[model samples]
Target: MAAVLLIESAMKFAIAVFSAAHAPSSRRALLFAQAALAGGHEIVRLFFYQDGVYNASDAVVTPQDETDLPKQWRTFITEQNLDGVVCIAAALRRGVLNTEEAGRYQRDAVAVSAPWELSGLGQLHDAVQDADRLICFGGA
Candidate 1:
């Protein structure tokens, strides 16, 4: 029989990855998130950089019967109480920023959210340094 511990106090996990587009990988990333929670480990932070930043866009409208990426991300973060930060430098170059960034750059009609804050690449280093285990999925 497989032993399943019911509680954990020291596990810290951080997920840093590229955009979870297309099949297989995207599905696996989501499944992995669920598995991490079930194993009594904590998801410390989830950072999406480069193309990965697109995963946090609020205006990603999929076809009918398609997965709503932003909603799924918000639900996971909200339920797990995890920090989800989309790298601001990456987002800015890719054109995904918050209200403050828009004002700073003097632009309009940006597609981002408060749930996913625009931060610098340094945040990733901070998260990785703080987490016990950091898993990176996908590529730039």
Candidate 2:
């Protein structure tokens, strides 16, 4: 007889990626997120910091032959009903702003879209406290 081990509890994961959208690390992070979701793990939060904030920018345009990582992230997060947060400070510094943020800073336009919101570092701290596992990608 074959024995099957079943997990009674779902694992909660928090992902933090600090790489630019075009960097290999960013793609790896996305793949990890997808895998986690596929494996029935819950993604409590997806935090983007430093150059990773660029992943939330609506202004990102990829070459015809290249993959549009930002768009892929947006679609995945949206479809999975995941919380995607971009560090406000890092985003502002990098010119990636949501509508409210643009209004707050008096910017001409909003660069970020749905499924990805601008928030403070406190969100990351909260996710760390709540999640069973915190996976970080790329260097600071």
Candidate 3:
């Protein structure tokens, strides 16, 4: 008699985006993330750093013909229940703020939404450590 063993292939992936929200790199990163989710991979964390922090800004406006990548990302992450983290330091430097951050900085308005949270660099480190694969998308 032969016994069959079933193996689960789902992998935990941590993604980091370092490009501006309007940059091609950012779009590519979103595509990659979509594909990863479609392929049944788990996204442990989606880290927005450097100019990528702009992706979390709620004030972004694009031309009618252009894709609203940040909006798309917001919908996607919200639907998937994925952890979308914007680096606190980077986001602050770029002026992308959530309600708490806006109040802390004494800003009159907040730019980031509820689905995305502002976090420290330690979150990124923990994601890298816990994920089976760490995928970074952006240009230097």
lDDT per residue (tens digit) for residues 1-140 in model 2: 11222244568999999999899999999999999877767899999999999988889899989999999999999998899999999999989988898898899978997888888999999999999999999875
| TM-score of candidate 1 relative to the true fold | 0.86
- What lDDT does the true structure give each of the candidates? 0.77, 0.91, 0.90
Q: Write the per-residue lDDT of candidate 1 for residues 1-140, one digit (tens) a residue.
A: 23433553547888886764444455567678778888777887889887787777776777779877667877887777778889888888888778889889999857887677888888899999989988887763
Clashing pairs in 1: 18-52, 19-52
- Clash pairs detected, candidate 3: none
For TM-score, candidate 1 versus 3, the one ahead is 3
Ranked by lDDT from best down, the candidates are 2, 3, 1
lDDT of 3 by residue, 1-140 (tens): 11222126778999999998899999999999999888777899999999999988888998899999989999999999999999999988888989898898899878898799999999999999999999998948
Model 1: CA > 4 A from native: 1-10, 20-24
For model 2 the local lDDT of residue 124 reads: 98
Work out the TM-score per prediction: 0.86, 0.92, 0.92
Q: Judge candidate 3 against the unseen true structure and give its global Cα lDDT, from 0 to 1.
A: 0.90
Superposed Cα RMSD, model 3: 3.2
* Span of 10 residues, lowest total lDDT, candidate 3: 1-10
